[model samples]
Target: MFDLDRWLEIFQTINKNKLRTLLAGFTVTLGILIFTVLFGMGNGLKNTFYTFFQDDAQNTIFIYPGFATKPFKGFKENRRIEFKNEDLALLEEKFGDRIEFTTARISKGTTVKYKSEYGNYTVRAVHPEHQYLEKTIIDRGRFINENDIEKDTRVATIGRLVEKDLFGNENAVGKYFTLNKIVYRVVGVFSDEGGDREERNIYTPVSTTQLIYKNTDKIDQINLSYDMAIGANGARRLSRDIKKVLKDKHNIAPSDRNGIYVESVIEDLEQNLQLANVLQIIVFWIGLGTLFAGVIGISNIMVYIVKERTKELGIRKALGAKPSTVIGMILQETMVITMIFGYIGLLIGNFVLNSMGNKLEDWFITNPNVSQGTIIFATVILILSGLIAGYIPARRAARVKPIVALRDE
Candidate 1:
């Protein structure tokens, strides 16, 4: 098992053709490196998508009006559909127990001013239940309450960014801000959201926004939260029921080609996650194909090396070396070269991923690291490739007749 002389001979042969050996080894190494990097990037993208989806309630549904694509009830195509306050009230009456929270929204992009400081931002009119649907945590004070909605108070909640820009470190509550020259008292400051879009909004009661903006009966959107106790399938069924009700009330057919649009966040997220998994599998196969090509190259090179070294092998056999001993020497050499270079490639790939992963994550890309399972799997593949590449050439050499091998120049 411990044949120092055999190993020395193998090393000396490789040393004589250092450049050629290195080139072959490098090809295999680079293939593995590319594979590792690509696989890591795929995983990272999957993680990023999953993280963003996690921030919102999985069972939430959004409803908005869009242009009708087909005529309905004598109305021409391209008619604008609009939802109203009464529609939201009707849905709540019918599905109150099944729904966790419901909110009607009317929003506009307008400039908000506090004293001398001003910023352009979106303002939304919402009910107290909007907080339950969004489940957003407040950093200071509290969100809108039922009293504010009932009395149509002119109080507002400002996002963290707005507070910082207008009031600096000072307490924002009790400060007055103006939108469209109408003043409203700031009642609360919302928490920062890592620069999420919602962090720039200014929120007030639906009734107050209607009165001030002079669009009292119109609403831009409606958001609903279904009880998690309902389960995902049940939530989906409830969404369909709600959609059916809206279509019927609006005098639109159930199969109307153009009508109100209902979007289920859960369904969208599930579809996206499935797509991400498929993409990861595709990336893995591409990387493996590249690595397989490299293994084939190594196998061909080893075959050539053995053919060229037939005379040396014949001399060894003539000196009483067993067939197993000759095979072991060649296998050992191949494995050593593969393990050393393969590991170097793995380290280099990991280093590159680590350096870029954080920057990508900041931009909302997820994990971005190759999993331990994948790395272990790759290592096994490398070893097996090396053994197979070496075994074929070694076996051919072992079968050669010493007389014939020695006859060659």
Candidate 2:
């Protein structure tokens, strides 16, 4: 089935018409290149969305105290709402089954000193379950435990950066650090995917912080992760129920939305995810449109090429060449050009993306890439476009009378 003569002739024609062939090839190449890069950047944007939320658990919810705007039950408007250790207990007692992990947060910034090295860092007061809530990974030793909370022990779990700052190359476990002139032994060294900022804090027992700082049971915020089995709707219902309970318990007005701010991570996550999906769809269409433009460009070029070779085609037909042979020649040439240029475009696009690395992270494009399936599909589309583009003009040329085509200027 392989015709060496016909293929050699096709090559000879391509060789003789370098400028025209280059122009056709350029159109195809440019189209696929643009499509590849655009789709890759779209994927990069989606990656940014996911990476942004990776620092915290997706099922987590944060409850921050806010001032009441309306008066109720002798309580005045503008009253500051404060969460206590009892609030955490109340949630556990009420929604024990619905909750997975709960923690009361007390954040304080203080200068930490170990030996000759020292740095100012935040001290996060938390329960053992805070590890899951913050996605903390213990690299050495252990996180804060129940006994540490119960005993109000003067101990802390230091962040990786904190250890680096205060201890240099020395391991921080079992070491002592001074915070506010009070000595606390480090029990663990931890890391976070949240980068350097998150890894610069020190974690201690909530009870210990309450006793040392203000000598009260006051907490800054409440954070918890719900059981994943409780779907998004269930999380919303639970959020509403929590707000109502906290409102009624604090004697705030029923309609007071500002008194208790319950933020559901899943809600924001779902919305952003929807946005990411929409962007991808838009990108896909944009890429498809670019590809269509290339197909059109090549189609036009094929028509022009046939017009230029009209007399030559007529002579071949007069010399006993079949109409199918004429069609085949044009189709074969188009295919060869399209395939070579399309593959070149794909390679160049991928190389550009790879070379970018994380340099475009500021633009929310991380590791932009097109999948193998997409590459194959695009290649197939280009080949088919070539066939169709060449077929139309080739068929018109074949249908012309030898005398009429010969008379063409």
Candidate 3:
């Protein structure tokens, strides 16, 4: 029941000891403030990691040839391993069902020119699957397609940076630019989340690049993936099977680890996920530690308050006050302090984080905010704090004898 008298009595007590209540409230506020800030920062770190991996499929794998460090199948050590387009074709033919996507790539540092402007840029010959692999964003025109590769067309998809420097603000689609003294028309303007280095490359069909560079059928690397939806374990298994088959084909001994290098994007993603979980646990532990300190302080103050109010409680008990009523009164005061303090802390935290939004802009962190669940959880914790802190003190007050409490100084 809503007791007006009880409410007025509670307010009277708070009004009588304003400074003491304020000091106790400050401790709770500080604890929640630290908690809110730590979680906000944790969220930022997680955002940074996700943004870094946004450019590629979570399940993607990259294969690069490496020099033989140990002799395999009686072959001499230090022999260089190279991949050819046939390797890709063979893999596709064999694992066509399991293989979801694939790309073969070779890069070169070349001078790109458009009349009076020229700049150092990377030229990459890639298959149609390369666009999806790189998470490419096309601003204009179209990316390299199967027809371009089959016909070996003298057409290129240039990065936004390439378009910017070579052609200024002019439309780059259908314009011609010379790469290594050979003219190729720009067919698309593309960009990626991979930042400036990735933006300095020009993409073209693999067949054309192989023919123009006089390195027919040669490729530097291959990217393959099973599926992102199936997650890391499935992707790992697929990659292992693919690697075993490639090892057998390349005359690489089963024990030779240096003959072919396999880098798993799935592994990186799994590691990031584990790290994010660990970070949340650590942040909450630290925050809870700080908050619990305030809880202890509140417990101590309630103890002191009980000692001071002993005589009054004894008189009330003599006048027919119930033990539960005494307990509820003490709990109500602690709850009020916690609610006010925690709310102020929550409000301050959100205001600060929101105000700093502009300054915190970048790939590192985005849209850091405390969720409603967090606020609700904090309030729950506050209610628990009130019950816990006031329990023993309320019990002691309930046990007071009228004669003894009245006799106390």
lDDT of each: 0.83, 0.91, 0.84
Please give the TM-score that candidate 2 achieves against the real structure. Answer: 0.92
Q: After superposing candidate 1 on the true structure, give the runs of residues whose Cα lies further than 4 Å from its correct spot.
A: 1-17, 73-77, 96-98, 192-196, 229-232, 319-325, 358-367
What is the alpha-carbon lDDT of model 1 when measured against the actual structure? 0.83
Tell me how many clashing residue pairs each candidate has. 2, 0, 0
Structure candidate 1, residue pairs in collision: 44-368, 48-366
Q: Best candidate per TM-score, number?
A: 3
How does candidate 2 score on lDDT? 0.91
**TM-scores for every candidate against the unseen true structure:** 0.88, 0.92, 0.93
Using TM-score as the measure, name the better of candidate 2 and candidate 3.
3
Instruction: Specify the poorest-scoring 10-residue window by lDDT in model 2.
Output: 1-10
